[model samples]
Target: MSNKKMSGFTIVELLVVLSVIALLLSIITPRYFGKIKEGQEVVLKQNLATIRHAIDQYYSDQGMYPTNLNSLKEKRYLRDIPEDPIMKNQEWQIIKAPNEVGVYDVKSRSNEISSNNNMYSEW
Candidate 1:
């Protein structure tokens, strides 16, 4: 009989391959998770900028900042307050002037942590 080598991988060889794949995944997963966190932070910053710009424009047109976040919606400045993606639909924090001066500061209501560990509300 002619000597022939088997082409199929042995069970031991297969196990080694699987183990290597698992090791690689373990090394890579955390990096991917970190990237996802960073992406969320970028999105939050963009949302913040958009809201700030809308507020500025509203102030420019109406001669003052909105008295409350609802006023922005009432005046048709924004379709609705954009949901804070990181915060999972939590209502934004609205800081209205206690003295009734008609200026409001808006921020996220949820304490969602950013990639840098800063709260989304503080962004």
Candidate 2:
């Protein structure tokens, strides 16, 4: 019989490698998701600020708030309505001015708790 050397990983070696990979994944996955959420939160904050700033500029220019986000876009106060980073949509919770008939402020539609331990809507 001719002698032939095996050129493959053994079952034990494969198991060890797989187990190590799984262990590393277990340790890393939660943190990865947390970081993703954190990134989304930062984006959410910036989007909110941008929309609010646009609303303020519109109000300042017109002496009243725009009737809706579309109005801002119509007059070029905003190029577009920003997507809510957390909700992944353009919907927002609009607050009317105390005595005015248009958007006075905007908040995230998401009620999800943020990393800072505050509701996203409250951001």
Tens-digit lDDT string for candidate 1 (49-90): 777778888878987778776787888887877777677673
**Model 1 misplacement above 4 A:** 1-7, 101-103
Q: Which parts of model 2 have CA positions greater than 4 angstroms off? A: none
Clashing pairs in 1: none
Q: Lowest summed lDDT over 10 consecutive residues: which window, candidate 2?
A: 1-10
What lDDT does model 1 reach?
Answer: 0.77
What is the alpha-carbon lDDT for the whole of candidate 2?
0.90
lDDT (C-alpha) at residue 57 in model 2: 94
**Residue-level error in angstroms, candidate 2, position 73:** 0.8
Clashing pairs in 2: none
